[model samples]
Target: MIRTIVGLIIVLALSVVVISSVPDYSLPSGLQGVGQDYTERGVNDTGSVNLVTAVVVAYRGLDTLGEVVVLFSASTAVVLVLTLVPMGANPTPSSSIVAFTSGVLPGSIVLFGIYIITHGHLSPGGGFPGGAVVASAFLLVMLGSNKIPGKSKLLASIESLAGVTFGLLGFWGMMMFGQFLNNMVLPAGSPGKLFSAGIIPLISLVIGAKVASELSGVFSSYRKAGGDE
Candidate 1:
């Protein structure tokens, strides 16, 4: 244990040193103008009021794909942990006040998460933040309802489906426009409208569901373990 801790500290120190030493790089002169170009293209070509969404889903979709993979890995880790332990081995009682708060707060949080996800194409919050919010709501649910069982298989299925759907969507884009994950085929409606961006909202929904289910599954497993004890 001492060696492990020491090794971890050394690794962290090395990472910090290396990361700090990385040279600062600026955008190319022509690329420096890309923000304005992206904004204009977002408004006209993608009809997305939020330039960030346009950049993430349309311009830099490969990065978004990587982010989804990270979320998937998190879900997989949770599933693996839960599977290693038997259910109903430990039970932990939660305070009534906490239960009440969890129940009441999660509803508002769910609504807010949806709002953030849907308006991602028009504002600051996008899939990542929105998905995190949704996961928080699920965590609340797991804490509040002790009797409720987590649907691990279902959650895993949803995560896998979302990942596959994203991949297929990217592949379709490649087939259509010779660029993977391109959103050009989407009908660019009026900027600021709910239906403006074609796949951004869809992707957000998938992300939200994936995050919520995975986190809920993890929380439920932990809660179940506590209940057993």
Candidate 2:
């Protein structure tokens, strides 16, 4: 009861702060808040045809990186929690189902995910969604078979390396231009092309790999814990 009262007091304080921080009480019409500022400046600033990608992976990169870190932390927390419980023996494998799902579905999902991650500068999708799609392939693998041969370590390693690479690159930019995760670290080539948008695409790729690996590792851990039916 004391804990609940304290929690309510804290919540009330936070709500009051939020309410006081709002500049305008009335909601503006569409595009009034954001305006054309982002769209106007995005093309020249990041050189990505996809304004959303430029904003996410270039302009507001640090926030995205923080989000990835949160995801990674959540996955780690899950692993730690699951470690308290003893895992069961591996389930029985189905040869035909495993063979077909492993052969066909994973390949297609991975290919499409890669396409989305790579072409992010030119298209609608980027690292987060694409990585989720790629991780789905791993889910399919887990659901289809009992023993997944020798990829969990690799995935974990990739996830770690990608996260480190992202941080290092951000520091590299800070060294060069006094800005964390500066988009100007690399040359921004022609827009709407594969190699355009400076470090945006590179960051997207790293985020994609990290997200995919982290999610795959989590799903694999759950399956190992006998959460699978």
Candidate 3:
């Protein structure tokens, strides 16, 4: 009862904060400054119908790169810490229902994640969410499988290569266009298509792969630390 009351208080407090902030968020009378520029030219500039993708992968690419680097660093730190510690107690065995669901669900979830990454330039979802979805599928597999899952070495290799490729692509854009992650380095195709948006889709896919690999490695390390074989 105390725990429930505390939870309700926390929720109510957050709700009050959010509701209080709502009045401060009046709709803009008109798009202005960078907002105006992006709305006016994002499609023509990056060939991504999804202006959010254009901003994330083209205009503000460096921010995304920094975020990925932070994620990688944090995962690496956790992995190293785990390596130094003694192995923890073995994990409890999964129930039959969990094992069955893990077996049946991961493959489809992975495919859907790939779809989300590939279509990011045309849709709402992108590399970050796609990668998280894939990682969650791996997490489910680990939680439900009889054995601790994920290949550590393979995940590391993939993660390293994807990180390198991401940097190399940024350099490539710089070489050609005097800017990092320049979307115009390659020809931008027709919008709302599978193979458009120059390097945005490619970078998005790379980000997804790197993020998935990094998270999978972290998950594997955690499970291994629990003395799972």
Candidate 4:
């Protein structure tokens, strides 16, 4: 315990030291430049209404790749935990009130999540937030509907497919554009159209599907283990 505590302290100290040593810049000025440049590029080059999506999926696709890695890591960690500690079956029947509420909630969440992901190029919501919302819906279902057990294998398969697709798409981009995640090959559809922004919508859908599946798997395992009690 002492060694563990010391290690944690050292890690925390290092993090603080690193953060403190970082150079500070005029954040507002930087943001203004970013926004102006993004807007100009969005109109002139991509013609996409959603500058943020253009940035995330095209201009800075590499960052999105890193974000996917983080999600994959989280899913892997959850799977490891579930495998090491077997969860038991559900202990109690879900209350009627909880069931009714949960039933209504998931539909609304699904709708909202879809909207968020689909309109990501036009609004603030994007793949990650949309995915998390879908995951929350799955969590609610797991909590309130014990009768409908989630399929772990199916969820795992979906997660794997999404991850694989993302990687393959990145590789394809590299082959076409000489950069691993460049969106240059994608048809820059008319800016505000639903199909615009090359691979942004597709990537968002993949991320959402993966996150939802992995989260459902995690929740299902916990529910089975009787952890909900």
Question: What pairs collide in candidate 3?
Answer: none
Per-model TM against the reference: 0.77, 0.82, 0.87, 0.78
Candidate 2: segments with Cα more than 4 A from true spot: 1-30, 33-35, 92-99, 148-151
Worst 10-residue stretch by lDDT in candidate 1? 220-229
In candidate 4, which residue pairs clash?
A: 47-191, 50-121, 87-225, 88-224, 88-225
Candidate 2 has its poorest 10 consecutive residues by lDDT at 27-36
**lDDT of each structure?**
0.76, 0.86, 0.89, 0.77
lDDT of 3 by residue, 1-229 (tens): 9999999999999999999988868788999999999999999989999899889888999999999999999999999998787666668878888889999999999999998899999988889889999999999898886564544578889899999999999999999979888888888999888899999999999999999989988888888777544
Number of colliding residue pairs in each model: 11, 0, 0, 5
Global CA lDDT computed for model 3: 0.89
Structure candidate 2, residue pairs in collision: none
Best by TM-score: 3
Kindly indicate the candidate among 3 and 4 with the higher lDDT.
3
lDDT tens digits by residue: candidate 4, 1-229: 9999999999999999998887684446445676788877775465457777778777887787788788779868876787677656565777899889898889999889888888787778877788888888878877786653645577878889998998888888889978886665678777778887777777778777877777777777666556655
lDDT of 1 by residue, 55-110 (tens): 88778889888977886787678768866877664345568997889978988998
Error of 3 at 14 (Å): 10
- Relative to the true structure, candidate 1 reaches a TM of 0.77
After TM-score superposition, the amount by which residue 38's alpha carbon in candidate 2 deviates from its true location, in angstroms, is 0.6
Off by over 4 Å in 4: 1-35, 147-151
Choose 1 or 4, whichever is better by TM-score.
Answer: 4
